[model samples]
Target: MCILFATRSHPNYELILISNRDEFFERDTHNTCWHTNSSILSPYDMARNQKTSPTNSETFGTWIGINKNGRVANILNLRPADTPPNKSSKGKVSRGMIPFTFLNTDSRKDSFSEWDSFEKFEHQYPCLTTSGDFNFFYGDIKSKSYRIIDTFGQTFKVLDQNDNDSFVLSNNTFNIENTKKWNKTEEGMQKLKELISKTKNESNNNIILMECFKLASICSVPEEIRNKPYHVDPAITYDTIFVPPLGSNDGEDIGLTITKGDFYGTRSQIVILVSKNSKHVTYVEKVLHTSDRDCKTHSAINPKDFHQFEFEIE
Candidate 1:
């Protein structure tokens, strides 16, 4: 996924994750669904070329997911410009493998500790490797602990639940230290903070929370900033379609995907809401269909794949 919004501390919920997975519309992917591996049922993904592994028939891998332990892990692929490109692309592990490795482990901390040593993991599976350039965010709601593995920043930022409750991460570096990411950081944070403010004075309500996340998922930058007389990537400007929260007929039927005739637009949406004192989480994922901007037949093309998995967090 390219864009991620997460809040660890909420007045009514333990955690909230609103994410958009942006990729080329042509990249084939399986529907996000629950899978059973030794009786553990969680949302899983299968790569386009499902022959990569024997378990591909059951559950392949995922870029982001939550386990039974209230532990959530999501990764964002760093753009080629953000880091030096790999010289030899002969062999490499899929980014989705990390979540599977973490969820299958008995101890979450141990799994992370093992992940900290990237070299050891690379040694085990020569082809299963990451560039150490991706942004890794994981946290345990029950433990009230979270951390961001900032490969671009070259630091492991440990976040206290009380101290830092909300965060927004995109394909670019999100800190002011890097001049390249300053504008995006400013715009994204503003929209996120607005969502936080809207839900601040309310009790635990899943519907309200979903709407808040929708706002984050579809928020865009100002026209003046977007149309600035400069050569820049449009993805940074965040011009995307808006989808209404469930149970509302307020949005357009074809407004599911970011069909803006550009590269790396919003291809899918994954929204997760975990309420405080609740055993399960509400998970919704929708992978939208590609549209033909010229034909105006986009409404006929609904989401190509959609899945909803609501279950206990253990």
Candidate 2:
């Protein structure tokens, strides 16, 4: 499972996100743009590759991605539904390609029309759900297009234009309730920071970043769930601080504070400080991971199988 948090304003984009993968895969890539791995055939890839139905197969899936054209796509796994079997299933589409395809094929101006096309395409292919499933949220800032597509459970919801705010989508559930409780933007940010801190560890840089992104993407916590204390065993916390670039051309600096099990791990959190006046990243802290015993095995949990939070960033 993966979570993405980002804020897009005109030409500038800020993103803090994380991706959680199942334990089987032991690789990570930091490519800026989206592309498919021809050698790695996931269920979605297989469907797309074979032009067959997605009944029972492992497929590629993505958390979030932003295209060079300023298009954005986020996907979450969802629960499979009980539909009548049909022989007319069209070729399936891979989830991994959604972000890249959305960004590459259509511009912001044509988002609405493009969404329609995607829906039609998926409906025909009809991916099957094992235990894993997913839903998608897509938007094109230039075109002012936004949509929510559920592949496994429930119907698609079209977000109102007024609903535009910093929104966070998480696994298993959507956190819309938290958005209503915070009276001030700072309060919300603090809450988000706190949430991310709970999931931090020192072992893997990607794992730590993924937890931070999950918190950053949150829009608000529901009142009912807000007061609830952490229940997951061995709760973790990590810190990520962003330092803006020094000069006009630099990117920005980021510092991470790592902690776990009510104790600071031997290795301090990594920090990535960007210099001012640089168009790209200036410096990155050393990568770290949780201890083997504390490190949880990564796995892909279907979007329908998890919860999500949608909030506004001030």
Candidate 3:
């Protein structure tokens, strides 16, 4: 299960967002890199199962990204009915491109920034989102404005800057007023609040980043529960933040193909910190597996080696 957590509660930072990207060990992924063409920074998912739209000429799509203009965009795939996401079967759309579009076209004059108004945003973006069921988060740190579009629910939410709260989204609905948060979301929020308290006196950004990594790695499912036939249960998934490969030990060719991609688990972790003044952004990503090769040649690829970068927001 993939999870994303963002906090505006920090005293020194405007936003501290961390995410755990869970996927099959075999999925091809491009490690975090700066896009020289667009001045955007993000990793790319090369799953080309879906038919491409005219706007999606590029073969790769992005689940999360940030631009030099201080726009941040991310997505969560609402936990499909199938265990390993059934990549080859029924998915007609690539959800990552929603965030990719946001990061690329968020210039103020470009109607993308009009996301603050529900009607304007709804009128503009629903066409792009009509094919997929997803949760998209778009934020302009320079404007201190954030908005969430849930294509599944057709709901538009503008995150209140004045709230100064931590928001956590897993595979569940984020209508905080109408729905109860999943255990994972609640626990993430509480842990984030505690992190804010514990690091109140800390000055080193690196330490804070490490703590965020540890915070995202809270994934440990009981053997009894994990060994059982995998169910698409949110409680079972939300039980922990990190997920180890399932059915890998029992079988040798566990995560060999998209058809045999049952070795589902957390593959990468991302932590992004934006300064309170919105002048700088620190982006860090640690890739645990780029392909099945990393699983066997563990020592060759240092999993904890983070692709880290800092950029001044223009």
TM-score of each prediction: 0.69, 0.41, 0.82
Q: Over the stretch 52-156, how does candidate 3's per-residue lDDT look in tens digits?
A: 577765556678889988889888866432336333221345676667766776465664456654355555555454535566777888777787767544545
On residues 1-314, what C-alpha lDDT tens digit does candidate 1 reach at each position?
A: 26787775567766778777665343345556544454333444433222345554443556677776666778776543333333222114455565565555554445444444334444433434443246667666565556665443343444455566677776555453554663444555567677767787776556654665465455454445432223334444333433211111222112122123322345577778887774668777766644223122221135556677777765
Backbone clashes in each candidate structure, one number apiece?
2, 63, 1
- Put down candidate 2 lDDT per residue, 1-314, tens digits, no spaces: 22323332111223332332211011222222224432111112211222324675433444354443445566654311122223111213445555444544445345345354344535433442221344566664445456665543443434333544334343323333543321322333455445435532333434544555333333232335322233311111111121100111111111111112311111111111111111222111111222222223211111112222221211
Worst 10 contiguous positions by lDDT, candidate 2 = 249-258
lDDT (Cα atoms) of all candidates against the true structure: 0.53, 0.32, 0.69
Clashing pairs in 3: 219-242
Error of 3 at 14 (Å): 1.2
The order by descending lDDT is: 3, 1, 2
Off by over 4 Å in 2: 6-62, 79-94, 108-111, 116-132, 153-164, 173-314
Backbone steric clashes in candidate 3, count? 1
**10 residues in a row with least lDDT, candidate 3:** 251-260
Question: Which candidate, 2 or 3, has the higher TM-score?
Answer: 3
